[model samples]
Target chain A: MLQQYFGELETGLLSAIRGSDGLVNPRKLYSLEVARLGKRLCSGTSPVAWCGITAPFDLLHSMGVTSSFVEFVGALLAVTGVAGAFIDTADQAGYSSDGCSYHRAVMGAASQGLMPEPAFLVGATNPCSGGLAAIECLARHYSRPLTVLHIPQDESGGNVAYLAQQIRVLAGFVTAHTGLPLDRDRLREAIENTNRTRAAMCEMYALAQRVPSPATSKDLSNFGVVLPLFLGSEAAVELACAYRDEFARRCAASPTTKKRETFRLMWIQNRIQFRQDLEKLLENEYKAVIVVDELNDVTWDEIDPEEPFEGLARRSISIPFNGTMERRVEHLQKLAREYRIDGAVSPCNWGCRQGTGARGLIQAGLEEIGVPVLNLEVDCVDDRKYTEGQVRTRVEAFVEMLHGRSSPWN
Target chain B: MAVPPADFIGFACAYTPLPVIAAAGGAPYRVLPMTESPDQAGRMLHDNICPHVKRILDRAIDRDLPELRGMVFVNSCDAMRRLYDAWRRVDGAAPSVLIDLPPTADESAVAFFAGEIERLARTVESWCGRTIDRSKLSKAVEQHNVLCDRVDALTRRVEAGTLEGGWSRLQAALNLAATTPFDAALKHLDGLLGEAPADRRRASDPPIFLFGNVLPDPDAHALFEACGARIVGEDMCTGSRTFTRIDSDSTEDSCRLLAASLLRRPRCARTFDASDPGRMSQDVLDAVKRSGAKGAICHTVKFCDPYLVRLPLVREALQREGYPLLVLEGDCTLRSMGQHRTRIEAFAEMLR
Candidate 1:
């Protein structure tokens, strides 16, 4: 299922990379997909186990810190501890929400018996202090070989070279650690499937420009929920096919019960349930559509299958995430205008600086272009902190602003 | 309960102002420890989530923390913001609000802070039903000012060599200051400020910027002092774990104080910029030069995959600038002072 989702979303992912689809809300997209997978895995006959720190290093590169992040971090940490084979990426170097106090605690505790119990620990980085500090601890404590890499927030050349070399080294280390080689064919297959998903997602999303289009945030989040499916195996082909058809059908239809979209919101986040639902509320009640939420369906380039993988490293750094607050804000501001968005929801990812740093600046910039902003704080992956009422109220208030019902929500 | 009440409390944490809740006639239940434990939050979360968040997520998922009236989530870290969102879904216990703070301490930051505080005050009024008369908030600030004065004086004493410091004591002190209400914690913090623990300033101080984690025992600073350099500033959890506040009443004043406090703190990630160290090497070198420090000392927890990456870049950036850094890697929860003593001494001398 995850594989097919990933495949269907592949086209959209590519477009994100090409700067075509829209601003990339990596955290929301990842969360919707991961949660879909988790929900499925949890429903399995056996306890669908998982393990990994649910920090937001990778998400930081795109979304920037959000209002909902604190609750998200606390919730994700609680959930991921008990899950099996959890692989946390947001806590790596350059992935912290801001400087420190990412969501909750800080400074490397994986070794101090911080993570509850996971058979394997996976780590990556792009040179943030907390990330290295944390990963070092995890590597030593879990007794797992670390797959350290230089994750460039800018994806700069100087850093890319270092990261690529490290990735090559990491490929070998992961193979040794998991006894699962970085199979070239498998990787290539994963890329191809991702391509399919992105293309399908792009087509579906494009329909929003049509009058009374059927696509909504829930639909987008659902479509996003299939990321892992597309990124996984051949089985994803089936799910991807369905997703493609579903999205196509939705786009062709007139708007469902979705309320008229008054002010389009470009939501930034790692997790979907909290922020994306705002889109649903906007559409259902206030009548709005988040034409572009970096999280739901952003285009991204496939990992160039080139030797030593140049594009993978490039994409790793450049692909938008909840890390790199400054960059994400810049891209978001640009996208707000490009997408004609009247407002934005900057969902603060807990584990990356990208998520935490720039609510004021982003809001100001967007307002300059007639878009209001609501910096929603919450954890992308942590479920415990999510408050349906609080989130709904805040988003509804923002939607009200979109309708020019009142001043921008405080 | 035995706790005294505060009308408007504050916490240094960027998110989940559990501490503030505790300060404000509520209980600030503890979150996760910065050590080894599978984040239960992550278990419920999707695979491939970051562990930093997992730590907090674990806290949100498992803990009841029902004693608080409400929580103010500070958007300090990105992961934290996300964590707050997920945990917010379970809002039966108490209401949670987001206290958004600007990144820089520029004029714009002050303005934004002013409006934000006003909005927040209104929100607080609605939630607590305690109308925040500006005068009342002013009094609250006044009390905080007293606490800040005590803390500032105590830190000055440490700088003046009038008092000997230890991480445990500092940790307890800051934790208490941040957690306990202003009046209550002031005395506790002041108590530490008065005494010289019968321990003299060692001949050599270990200059370390503990990135985040600090061991509970075997005092790494003491060990470094035994080696050579005097411990200056650090990037650790328990170092100059700064204390200050941002109030709407005195926006500029509060921001100045807050900004200064943040800058002077000994957090390892404090390299001018939050995430980018290489871009700030010159500043790091300049800061060290100004401080007359010889090295950059770091202590990391075992399996801390994130900080390790910073090590490589920090090395590249700082080394090129001719400033040597000594990394003391260890499980912050355990004692690595003994093992790192040798490294500390050698690195300190190497700087010399």
Candidate 2:
């Protein structure tokens, strides 16, 4: 049922992006679309405001716009005079260790209503604390309450409590504010189906470990099943099920198990998503073990419905992509070892604090674990911010590292 | 105090508490201090949060606040949006309320603020299940006024008592600021006005004013103790910044207080204009003069954008003023002191 919901959503969202004229004040254009979309989504009797948090991936996707702009604009809010704050705990410092600037920019933007009105604001640990704080600030400014959910990287008990609490809070809030109680029976049924979906997700990951695995981001789009389980309606689940099935079909079609001096790796940066040419150079020239990434949806974990309402709240506090820095690095190490993947390519997305700043630390840590990690500084989404050759050369050098050649990449 | 299991609703109303309100009456059971949930408050936003808002999330997710009967939100930044929203949205949550105030000095704004404060007072009265006696509020304010006067006097005492004189006043102020209610603090301050001076005195101490990040532990204080720099003053939220609020007595008095407090905040993400970083620097310099501090130290918390970004600018300003300053950065953990001592010492040296 949920799969069907996400399918419609994804289709609708993608179609909007594809059809838009894409001209207007970027902020206004974006905010108006956000508010309009929010009004539409919220108009429903049962709207689980997907609240798509702008993580490093989204920020690199948007080219460092919103949240960062919020901070400077924050000061401007008190335009008539100098305002006072007991202590400024602004930015993404407390949550994610990656220290991503994009987190702050989006957080600022969201707090100031720069993004679509998320049923509630959301953020993650990688890009850090700015998002959550920004949301909190916004809630205060607008007198609108917030519903938070945290994700845990490791599917341990940590994620359970936060998730449960979120579902419960959201459930009650929807009922109170909109005057519609969640169909308890429907919620329970959703839980059962989500559990099935969860099992399928795990199985898909298992399939990903296969030699010469050809799992695509599209395949693992619902790894944690957050969108489908939490935000996706029945339509979302249907879409996910379809995508998962397609993933299986693709893996079956590509069964070359032996390496021909070419490597398959996961590309994990947002801006990098905009630069597959680098991926092409690595594949076409110096065959490196670079392939699909685990940073996308499915790898992150699902929001369990079986858990009580309080558990959802706990999940909101510690969900994956919602975890702290320690969780992220640890998560990365776990994924690498679990998949027996070779080497990591950590990109420093330009002005993308969360994605890039952690390179220095992640590079050192991953290196110690038999993983040859390269911290490449480049823009992922904006073409103007990076020259193609510069990107190609950097990537080529890293590919050489994967090949065990003593070639300098930096 | 832990909200008993029987009454604890969990999740939805988690951030909202009835403790602080309880304290104002039958012992305020400040509950904001209890839960140590992880913070992803700003993680959803891109790179544009203020340092202060980050602290709130850090506290929410990391620290064990002593919890209040019902905590108050001084609307200082946009980051507070979710903080208040979380309270309102949470189900079975405590009676959540806010003190709305303007940050500017417009007369009409201030008048509106006074009305807001009165309205808030009435709300508090309703939550308390009784009306607040105006006489009591006035008395509390007066008593607090006395405490402020003596604490101000104590600043001079520190200068007279130390080789690197200045510890006595700031220490007293901090302790008094932290534990005492306005009334009790004033009475204590009034009593300590003529307290006997210690015979032991030192004169070579460096009077350093700590700014930026709010030090969660007293290690910074201890370090200052060791380095002979008495912590004269601070604008950090956890410092003198909170205890010193505006004095008002109108319908919008609380609003005026909030506005005054916000305006007095040193340069912060939610305070100073990014284009006008100079406003904060100049304020810090003024704080230094008002506190009679000789040098300045900037402590940058991990991932704290405002302070981290402002340290250089502040340092430049301090240098320009021929005022010694030190920049130290660290995560707000009790166990990380060893890793930070060297940096603190180096900063102390610069101040000295």
Candidate 3:
């Protein structure tokens, strides 16, 4: 069923692109690339790995592995409206409902024999313990080899070397499993691809800071976070370039073509994958556009191909979510200022301790910078407990409150 | 004139090295969650976070805990890390340091963790206005090792079914060691061992091995005893895992030696053995067999992802070994354990 779903989605996306005379938007390209990756994973023609979100996808792609984080599968399940059944399956199997729904959905799917068997598994101990726990469970259930990267919170010289050594060990482990040796040339090329993608993303994000922001809530929803899965491949570069071009065109377009931006907002953490109505309500009803997302910024420097492991290790540890709350808040403060954010909406995603755990600190940090925040205590994946009316009312009231206070930009 | 608060350094996780704090001229105080604290942490943290962390944060928010000179936190898990973050926000005046503990116990990880421990020592030194004397650190390690040896002896008695009162007594001793000064706890242990009674468990009470993240409530253990089950073995943060012995002679540097010893201790679910994904379950099985347990009971706190995620594998291993397994979810309160009374009774009966 997953194979057929991906196959149909891939075909439909291709047909849509072809029908539009190859005038593809970044969102369509990104979706098509993800669909293709999904189809390949289901095809099982190559080595497939279920990894943590912070895993080095570029290196995996360089090794000819079809790898993506487990959360992507969960998001796919949620967006397809079939996550509830999987979640129920997991709950019945004695998995706690209090755990992250994304993991629960994937675990449920794996139990139901809906997921493809991977050759090995890789986990990273950063961002969230829940993610690594779910990955370890999957490794045990599949009876496969697992390599966990112990990402330290502080990115000191010793810490970076430790992580780099582990990444090298991971490369060896992947080789031992898939019988594909790491080619330095291929790895260099992959790093080069990532550098290109990062440059394009920087331009795209900067263009998004325009007065009538060139981006929309749908345009950047989960875009920055999920784009890393394709970092080593040309798909990521193309998708990023398309976004940069689109944003540039929007920024340079005539006044009438640009969308009215009454209030520019920032989205904290992840947006709800299954629901689009909230974005529509914010855009149509309140004239509030989410111009930036928490994960949208280019935080790391360009990876030097000569010392790729060190660069990758530094990038992995430098993610805002991996380190202290002070570091994350500092990053948010910078985003709020650069994006000219009026107010922020933090969807304190249920069961996400890494992101939502620092709810009060994030609120306090933003308010310290005179940016009010609205925290919606709702699950982004599992909508079973979500009350749409309550969320809508909260968002509308937050927007009204923002209107009462003058914008910081003014 | 009012006296200044004692030089107490509060901590929450089992992974915090008490010897370093002791060497730095501070008292190590393990902060356990209390049921009496109000549910106000939801204002700072989400409602779905681990209850252990929430309750700890509640005490900090309500100022229900004792005054401390400093706090130490280990980056053990997401909830624990959040507790550190929330605690710093709630009690901004307390000088605190968070040690970054590596998840894997590899050589590289051990070395990195040793550096983190050294960094922690420097932070604690600044907080206490004293240096961590090497000789003092060795002495502290020796004293901690003595406590561990006594705990292990008591644990062996429980495993042999020769110790009276089973887990409750052992838990009380461990809790005392965790919260009180080392000398005071040592004195209490000495008195308890002097007056220890032989096993008086009934034949109908099945021996069970228990495992979880945190079960600090001694009443919860008494509840298991009331349900007619003898807890012969346990692997909990607040129980056996807290008393890991440090090999002071392993390395010249006290911090490195402490790091190596702590990393080599019996790992919790939060620490993963990547090379052997089944190691945790196998460890539980081996411990259960060593204890001659007829069944196993896993008591994990709700929203504790580290333990909750690995529970099914542990259950599978226990079942494969012909052991009946009972799983209980709680909120670090005796009330939550009380709700599982019937299930525990049924499980004990099934084992019998």
Candidate 4:
């Protein structure tokens, strides 16, 4: 079913590209790349690995392993509307429904033999504990070797070295499974590609900071976070470059585009993947443009290829979700100031203990900077719990409250 | 010279080293979940967080806990980390230190965790307004080790079906050790052990091995016993995990030894064994084998991701070994646990 879905998506994306007279649609191209990855995973031709969201994809890709985080499959199952069945399978198997739906879906898929069996599993102690647990379960289910990167909360010198050493150990673990040694040149190339992707994404985010923001909420919904799956490849760099050009064009043409820009909002954490109506409702009815996403910013500097492990370690630890709440709030405040957001919307993704766990702190932090926040107590993946009407009412009330405030644009 | 009243340092996770807190001139007070607290933690943290964390936070928000001089938290899992985050916001003036605990027990991780423990020692010393004496720390380690030895002996009795007051008494003693001062807890444990009947053995009840993250409620254990099962052993953070002896070398650095010893314990689900992915399930199997149990029971808290995610494999491992496994999920409440009485009875019946 996954193969067929991705195959159809690849075909549909190809048709859209051809029909557009070969115009480079970054969104379509990005989808095509992901579809190809999905097909490759389903094909089971390459050595695959199931990893946590914060695992160094570049390192894995450099070692000739096809890897994607378990949540990617969870999100895929969710958006494709088959997550409910998988979640039920997991639920019936005694997995708690109170856990993250993303993991539940993946575990269910694994139980149903829907997930591609990987040669090994890599779990990272960042982002969330649920992801690590899911990875461990997958490793146990498939009878595969597992390597866990214990990403530290404090990004001190010793912590960074600890993580870097773990990354090296991870590479060793991968090599033991795949019988492939770590190639220095390939790692260097992968790091270079990652640097290029980061540079383009930084440019894209800069262009998105325009008065009438070029990017739409739909344009970059989960684009920044998911792009890392393709980080070590030329495709990631291309997708990023295309996004930068697209944002640049939109920014240049913004003055006469007749785009409604009443409230420039900041979307916190991940947007809902199973539905499109929320973004449309916020954009069309209220003219509230999501100027930035919490994860869209480039938080780390360029990686030095010579010291790739150290650089990757720093990047992984520097993610807002990995560290203390203060660090996450500080990053959110920076984004709020840069994007000049009127208000922030925190979906407070249900069962997400790491991200939604800090919902109160995030709200308080933003409000401290004179920005109001609307926390939608909704599940991003499990649509079963999402009441659209309630979400619409809350969003509308939030927008109304924002409208009552004095506009900086005026 | 008379010892002054011990300043109480509140902690949540079992990963927080009690000896370090004791050495820093503070009584290690484990803040456990209580059903009496109001549901106010959801306002600060998400409602779907681990019930243990939420209840702890609720206690803090409601000011239902005792006067704590400081707080120590371990970055053991996401829920614990969020609890630390929420605790700081709810009680900003209290001196709190969050130790970055590594999930793996590798050498590098041990070293890193040792540094974190050392950092914790400094912060705790500052909070207590005195430097941590190495001799005092060594003595604390020795005392804790002796306490662990006594608990192990009592645990052997529990496993051999010879424990005097059964699992409830053991759980109560463990809870006392967790919540009270080191000397007082040790004394209580010694008292319990000295009074325990040696020859009387519970032979008819089904011997069941229990495992999960945290099951601090002694009544829950009593419920299992009432349901016609004798809990031979448990691998919970509040039980065996907390009581695992810290083998200390007086010549070695105490913090490093403590870090090593804590990591070496039968790991919580939050800790991963990279070298052996199947070690967690195997650990359960080993415990079950040692206890001579006919069945296994896992009592995990609601919204506890670490245990919830790994439970299927545990069930599979037990099933492969021809052991019936019963998993019970509770919201850190006796009422939630009460709902599982029929199921536990059925499981106990099947084992018999």
Error of 1 at A317 (Å): 1.5
Residues A1-410, model 1: lDDT tens digits: 33343344554555554673543344334444444443333233221111122222222111111101122223334343421112233334322232233322322223223333332333333323344344443333344443334344344324456445645664554445445456666556555555565565555555544434444555454334234333433434444454456555655554553346555666665434322355556677766666666644443554454442554466556645524444555666666655656677766654444334334445555676566777666655445456778988888777666666442332
Tell me, what's the RMSD of every candidate?
Answer: 18.4, 15.9, 2.1, 2.1
Q: Which stretch of 10 consecutive residues in model 2 chain B shows the poorest summed lDDT?
A: B7-16
lDDT of 1 at B208: 39
Q: Which residue pairs clash in candidate 3?
A: none
lDDT tens digits by residue: candidate 2, B1-352: 8644121111111111122222224222222211245544444332233333444444444433433334455443232433444343333335545544333333433444454455555666655555555454554444444544565566555545532224434544545444444445556655555576653343466677777644545445566667666566666544444334236465634334544443544435334331222356677888788767778877655545434444444565677888887666654544455576776667666665
Rank order (by TM-score, best first): 3, 4, 2, 1
Model 1, global lDDT: 0.46
Output the lDDT of residue A198, model 2. Answer: 52
List candidate 3 segments past 4 Å from native. A257-259, B1-6, B157-166, B196-199, B250-252
Where does candidate 1 stray beyond 4 Å?
A1-120, A126-137, A208-213, A222-232, A235-241, A255-260, A272-281, A297-299, A306-308, A322-326, A337-339, A349-352, A377-393, A405-410, B1-352
Mark the regions of model 4 whose C-alpha exceeds 4 Å error after superposition.
A408-410, B1-3, B157-164, B196-202
In model 2 chain A, where is the ten-residue run with the lowest total lDDT?
A: A56-65
Candidate number achieving the greatest DockQ relative to the actual structure: 4
DockQ of 2: 0.04
lDDT of 3: 0.87
lDDT of each: 0.46, 0.44, 0.87, 0.86
lDDT of 2 by residue, A1-410 (tens): 22333345546655665676642222222223333333343344232232324221111111111121222222222221211110112232122222333333333344334333433333232123343444444443344444433333233433444334444554565456444556755655555555454555566566666656655323332133223322223433443455455446656866553443256565554324332455546555765545445454243345445543543344344333433334556666667666666767666554443444334435545565666776666544333345777767777777766667332212
**Estimated TM-score per prediction?**
0.45, 0.47, 0.96, 0.96
